[model samples]
Target: MTTTNAAEATTATAAARATGASAATDVLIVGAGPTGLTLACTLARAGAAVRIIDKSREFHRASRGKGLNQRSREFFHDLGVEAEAAASGIEHITLRKYRDGVAIADTVTFADRTPTPGMPYASGLIMPQWRTEEILRDKLAEYGVAPEPGCELAGFTQSADGVVATLADGRRIEAAYLVGCDGGHSPVRKALGVGFEGSTDAEECMVVGDVRVDGLDPAYWHQWFDEDAAVLLCPFRGSAHWQLQGIPERDADGRPAAPTLESFQRLVDRCSRDAGIRLSDPTWFSIYRINVRMADRFRVGRVFLAGDAAHVHSIAGGLGMNTGIQDAFNLGWKLAHVVLGRAAPGLLDTYEEERLPVAAWTLNLTDERLRAVVEGVKEAGVGTEAVITDDVTTLGVGYGWSSLAWGGAKAGGRAPDAPCRNGRLFDVFAGPHFTLLGFGRGSAAALAEAGEKCAGLLRTHLIEDGDDPGGHARRAYGVEGDGLVLVRPDNHIALSAGADRGAEVVDRLLRLGR
Candidate 1:
């Protein structure tokens, strides 16, 4: 940890008020990984002061989770960070399932949606975790914030008024809310005495990293499900670089019997004898111990947990970071509202109710993915809906149970995207403002009514450009005509309606966040 100063002393004072310790911060985030960083950026963009601390002194160079789902892309786009990530060697892949080197099943591809919103990233993206972090860091910098590195959360105490955290140096920083975006083994979780009761899987999956190999292929994320051993390989930037993992019977070379280039190579040779391809080189390797577990609760008074601190799951779907990022996304604004006194404390509680169920659902599905591979379902025999729900980036994931959820429209089930007169493809759910979608002139007066009451508190958009937009926005979100929609600050559809229904839709929206 670094030396503390007077500025550090006051950082936690903005989060309402705290008991015991008086340090205040609007949001005190523990952990500067993707989730924590995303939370910081989201809140800061909305003008909330934030402080994020990470135990790591610097960005981790090793690559993890080589695939980024579609839902994540939408969130990143809203943050205005996805553009750089999309350009930074992120490959657009046609997801495929292969068993013993034979293509068996293909995932729901993003190809059918012509000219999707958040284009270039309309589908899944293949980019390394480090690169993703780089983009996030850059975005954070734009907000005049930097992550506090090498400073760990030593201990903390929370109360209804606020959370007071005791630093390793014995200083107290207070914030109205404290979030543990920490990992599965969170210090904050330990301090809170939260119960993480889920059990671990029997399997031990090993992974190896960042090794440059001449013989590896660059086009796809490949998996080999041998009844005895399974291999997962992801290519890096069309280069010889790859991340490989294997389940080993023993720790040869004294390395953890997890994934490594060596083990992957050996497994590749074995699978080749069965399926006929050769793998070479000795690079990075490590083993993963799978645990599909989640905390019994996400919030306890002023203290909250997000990301892996809330749930831990298999690496099967590469969902760990994405899930946490979404966790941060869900909670960031509610905390801001609570702090700014724009909404009631009850709104913050919805964060747990909404995100916890999604986490549990994701953990279960990912666990099944691991089971499918381990049980030798063979990528060919795999019928898993890796992303059946669509909006893999998690942007489409909704909060069906919210006080602000005024009513349901025909597009109630999925995430909505639309063409706008503003020459932009608007995702009805990207946070940072109160969004008003205008289908026609009839809804304009009603929208103005809602906007006038909110003052500088709401941002309104009218979705009235009748042009086809070449079916770009229509196919991406399946909305073909002008329709009014209201998006909340947390990126969820508040209300949707056609021209005739605009007044009714605006009336229901005016009823929200009051």
Candidate 2:
């Protein structure tokens, strides 16, 4: 809701004045959206110098990306913003469906879900994208980093040493690596000559925005559907506005009419057929045409693409922003490690390898869900229920096929959470460091050795049967007797092995540049 002030901008500018226009930073992030901000926070927390910039003159307030899935919550948990996010978001709001002013079915959003020891956060939360970015920006500020506004990336050239990016204002910035989180039409991806391959649905379009709504119950996501037009109004938490999505009238050229507050009210009136329910004070709006696409490659030498720069998909699954955030999460630790000299440069390769498949599958899944939703709308009046699948939650996204996944059956997958004597496994893995969990007393020596070897880079915790009363840790990890699970900084399982193989895993980490 707030942009970086003069002092923060001056601070960022002063920090960048050292190398070229800015060589003091290790990474230069282009774009201040959820993806770029998440990456900036991740890198900054790891003490990797970063300078984030956005071409926009000021932060745009919008209800663009309103859903943060469970996996993304975990990412925020690592970034130290989950508490604020939880306080600012709402969950388990019911969907009240209607047809031509007649009330229809009432469906709970995330019904039949409960948090377990293995996965504490069971459902996603609904918060506007701007609020999410604000939380990230606030966190980034704690590290003395702020996103420079109205800064555009004109072009860039990379070499073996680093990347030199020329801004639109003719200022050059030198960084060890550059990332593009600029969105679907990213100039960074264009500069890299990467191909964005996908199709756009011209026929399917909706007007989406934030609006102050009255005479509607805020407890439910109100939806109204008829034969042609449809409208959905979901209340945003900690605010008086609601996220409005409705079918607008098309012009002779077949384009949806301009997204004005008046136009939105007309659409709502036409669909809901209720004059008492009103819309006003539209803060931000967009004519969302369903776009499904992904970049051919995620990285080119020292330059990389993330978020919408790397992929875009239908809003069916509400995975668009979450995917980008996860892309940044997947790339964040690897970039930090490489930039901070904690890992080999080769570690960055797994970013694309692990996320490319996820994007491809996400595209297919969202497309299918979109089609199903369309069909559901044609049959009944509700369709969003079609998008609420386990895959949409993104908890199942993993990289088991990645080379970094070494020994355990669940290697390269998301490390599960469990209760421990001190707190929880997640409590130990909260910060910007790798986590090595030693289950059983036999692994204590290996824990000590890893502690000394890895030092600040790795956090080791011993989990014995008595330490976890419910045995959730043992079951979640499939640890039989005495074993070790090495979790990457991104919370992905790097490897898992028996107690005797702990030294082997440690040796592998050393070979992989630690």
Candidate 3:
């Protein structure tokens, strides 16, 4: 508040930087949401120093972006928070639809499928966005890194060597890289002068809030559909609050009403058409308009954009938050590699090349799903179920067109999880190391060569018939004989080739780091 205090703080920061105890980090994360937290956990797991900061002084208790797709669950598993997230979230949530206040249809939000040896997380989880962030934050704390609250990125400048970021408090932090995980109206993206081109539907708006309700069953996600309006009340896992979403009546100015408790209560009363059901104790609320947009570039020099800073999707398929989380997952390893000098800086270019198309596809997919929901509501009083296709799970997403993908179609796709005598293929692929699976006894020589040559950079496993008694690993990889599959740190297949070409594939894997 005074000049003396500001001078003392600056002096203290300088002394700390000189003593290597300052805000300077290997990576400076400019947001503390799920995306930023996921990135922090990822880089920290690899022993890269990270400092995550958020502008907000207090953590949010709102129920925003309240679901995780199957692919996201896999990342959570990789981050070592699967058990905690599972304990706090529910999977296979059922949607109970109603017409004119009478129950009409009951459907599960996910496609009915059995978990196989190759795909253990076949279903998505229903958890509040706040809890997801909490889980990630808790995991990040294990690395002795916690988000700095009330610290905001005022601006930043990057040279060829590193980035110097200035905070709102007149503190300067130097880091090898800076990431923008701030949401839709990202200051980082805006400061970079990057173009965010997309469309926003002003007419299509939903009132979302967390509230305590009476006389409603907490088992199913209750949806009430009318001729022109709809409402959905979903009970959050491990919390007394139910996330309420409703299409509210617009005003003469063609804008939805404010997201106040009274307005939400009115919406529930009108759309639900239930006299017994009542809303009370509203904690958080917001009016969400459909905004589908993507930044022109994910990277500008050493500064990078990720998560909502790079892309924003409609909430139709519940992909907005998950996409951001995955964006962090995709960029985390690349940033760590470059910062740790394990890879060339050029490897960072693949981030945009691989993720831009995915964001474009996501925007298009959510738009279609939103349209389908609108049409389904008009035709059959249904919408949520229309968005539950397998495509929304993001398991089918890949980077086959990426420059890093070698070999055939299997390369660049997510490496399937398979049962092994020890544990699972994922266990072998875990951590911040490349994985080389040499299938069959014939490839043992190649595995040994890779293990000796690559050492700490790669982990080689010779998966023989005895190691996979059930033959799931071979079947999952489509390898009938000796073959080699190289998996990247992000669990994407880098190369899949026959045993005879294993030596060549190993050489190619070695070149990726350089």
| Native-referenced Cα lDDT, model 2 | 0.84
Q: Give one digit per residue, the lDDT tens place, for model 2 in 382-408.
A: 657878889898898889999888867
Ranking by lDDT: 2, 3, 1
Error of 1 at 116 (Å): 3.8
TM-score of each: 0.82, 0.94, 0.94
Tell me the deviation in Å of residue 486 in model 2. Answer: 0.9
RMSD in angstroms between candidate 1 and the native structure over all alpha carbons = 5.6
TM-score, predicted candidate 2 vs. hidden true structure: 0.94
Candidate 1: list runs displaced more than 4 Å: 1-24, 94-121, 238-240, 249-265, 273-285, 375-396, 410-415, 427-431, 465-484, 497-514
Q: Candidate 3 — which residues are off by over 4 angstroms?
A: 1-23, 252-254
Q: What is the C-alpha lDDT of each candidate?
A: 0.66, 0.84, 0.84
Instruction: Give RMSD to native, each candidate.
Output: 5.6, 5.3, 4.9
lDDT of 3 by residue, 1-514 (tens): 1000011011222334466765457889999999999999999999888999999999999889998888898888888888788888878888999888788899986557768888888788899989999999889999999999999888887655567888888998887778999999999898888899998877778889999989888889999888877889999777999999998767788677688877777777776674578889999978888898999999887778899999998888999889989999999987777666566667788999999999999999999998898898898787588999988999989999999898855999999999886798888887888898999899988888888877767888889888997899888888888889989888899889887876676576566645
